[model samples]
Target: MAAAVAPTDQGPLAGLRIVESTAFIAAPLATMSLAALGAEVIRLDPSEGGLDHQRWPLSQEGASLYWTMLNRGKKSVTLDLRTEEGREAAARLVCEGDGIFVTNLPARGALAPEALLDRRQDVIVVTLDGSPDGATAIDYTVHAACGAAQMAGPAGLDSPVNNAVPFWDVIAGRTLAMGLLAAELERRRTGRGQHVALSLSDIAMETMANVGILPEAELSGEARPRQENWVYGSFGRDFETRCGRRFMLATVTGKQWRALLSATGLGTAMDRIGEAFGAPLDDDAERFRARHAIAALVQDWAGARDLTQIADAFAGTSVCWSPYRDAAQLLAEDARASPRNPMFARQAHPGVPPVLTPRTPLRLSAHPRLAAARAPDLGADTASVLGPLDTAGKEADP
Candidate 1:
């Protein structure tokens, strides 16, 4: 390839380089973030591509949309690390440039910290694992272990309900990105590399800690109760509109509650319902305890009007509400057209239609705009990458 185009202004991570040897979401997403911020990210996959290359939700041509979305704007090199030559090439790739390697692969045997550090002492090695002790796990298993599945469904359901979103994987990916950036900054200051390790379980625990869920349960000896379609500890729920559209509404503050009542024209009805319970619906706790009564009034009002009518009513109010939309609806309205979407870049692949992908959410005035490029096909850059590595190895030979 001709010299990579040099942008007039590079992003905040302009001088950084990250070598990624991981499949799936967490590790790939972490490096992708760095790549978006202008880091040179070179990803390594097995000779036939990693498991993620075959992930479902593919295009008509059987290309992995999941893999393409996660690995966007990164160079891809495929190698069979089981071979001695492949191992040498992998080591050379790790030791090249800024010498930062991120992977979720096994911590022992091949491609471990010891092996990479042996190749380059100043190499920054970051590994994300299922547990701190190197146990293997994926998002679903980690999410299940974190207690989220148990509290997911409606009240009175005995079975666990797994969420559609891979919550732990998303969090762990961001966590890994945070660690990589921090290590980069420290490496710049100290001129020394470090090994950053993160576990999916640990990330889940941190998330619980941040939300105060574990502490609340420990102190009160009360497990979180399922409140399907309702905001936990609050008076919010999903109601069907006259047009058969489901909408979620929440009011966290007194002002919001008053506005919601006004928006629905239900203040008087709420007052009457509150009187039936001999309780004033003036606080969150009261409304929460009497949520059934409150929801009845809301349902009656909301059910009598179409989504458009309800949306018009909410336009000038402080009521927090949105109509439930499926994937197609969201893609048509929010993802494709909404100004709120930060990842709005459109990239065209050779045989594929243009795709709209979200970029890193960080918005920095000093940083240059991120590059918009499609994910490379398997081993697309292998010759360009390995040719130079081979030349360097021969030149350094005695």
Candidate 2:
């Protein structure tokens, strides 16, 4: 209630303010990014708290690191929007706020219209929905039904496997931030407010646009099975090297393939190794792996090795050596130069950096991208938020 800290140092969207009426990932993240960019973001949550207040993947003492991570430096207001009093309080706040984000979707019989749009004419209203248009599904359900989980990998002996990570969250977070920023940018230009809506399903589909629509693009609905770590026409697949030191996983391109051959002690002339590893069949996966097997033989292939080493080794290489990193590992560095997160820091652990997912990848130089207030703590500033309501409350208390 005293001094509200701006989330980041970016000045792309300076002087912008947003109100969050979201429950979980998508909506909150959208607003969080806005706050990170120096926008005054006030999150409206339920007084009772949501599922995230005490969910899984906890710390040793059962602390919801999940909640802490997502809501690191955000202010929260626990007003009951379902009640008339609560609605009025929120309406008043939204009417005055520059931006408002909600988890409610838009469509046939969906949005509450005037109820949530208290400031329809004054502020930016961003919504996060559950599904795309007429359909709906949760994160896991969507991932399972959509073919992402199916194509994750081949079974050792039985059924297929699913990716362990919550890939949809990452994708949806990205989509939500992008949508919110887009809306904010437009508002800045027009000097008029607008509503921006997005759904987890929509975000998920967009994230998998290349693969989800691959079947449709090819004129066939028969989707491709899990390729695991292999892509078509790409030889020299990821394999374990000898000495069990680290894994050599990368997206080998044509030029990179030549380098790999030389790096692994193979000769410059391709014809020389044809008899031993077979001829390079252009983009043949089998031939590439065969030729690349020599390097794999010495590379520590299991996932046990630190993924960082793999990424570090390919820092400036032509090889699209895209190694898979866990959510925690990626945010290890401070704000990066390419659309970085200067606001993200270890507010909880001091010097220990908190784990971050990823930024929206959208950049704005002139506009303050981050530098806003943290999410509130269950209407902690209710008196300040709804001062008129407080006056009314005092008058009605007999």
TM-score, one value per model: 0.91, 0.71
Candidate 2, residue 283: lDDT: 47
Tens-digit per-residue lDDT, 1-398, candidate 1:
54444455467777687888887788998888878877878888887888788798787777888888888879888887656677667777778777888988754444678887777778889998888776778888877877778887778899898768777888889889899888878877887787899988898878887898888888999878877878777789899999999988987788889999877778888998789888888888888888998998888888889988988999977999888888889877564444346546667653346777666677665543555667888899899878888898799999
Residue 194 CA displacement from its true place in model 1, Å: 1.3
What is candidate 2's lDDT per residue for 1-398, written digit by digit as tens? 54444455544555666666665565566556655555666666667766576566576655565565566445666777666666666665666455454555331211244444443654656666677565666677667666566666653424545556667766776677777677667777887666676667766666567654554545775766545555544553455423233333443455775555444433444444455566653445645455455333424233333555544445566645544335454444423422255533323321223443333244454443433233334557665766765676688897
TM-score of 2: 0.71
Q: After superposition, how far is residue 91 of candidate 2 from its true place, in Å?
A: 1.5
- Which regions of candidate 1 fall more than 4 Å away from where they truly are? 1-9, 107-110, 272-282, 335-342
lDDT of each: 0.80, 0.54
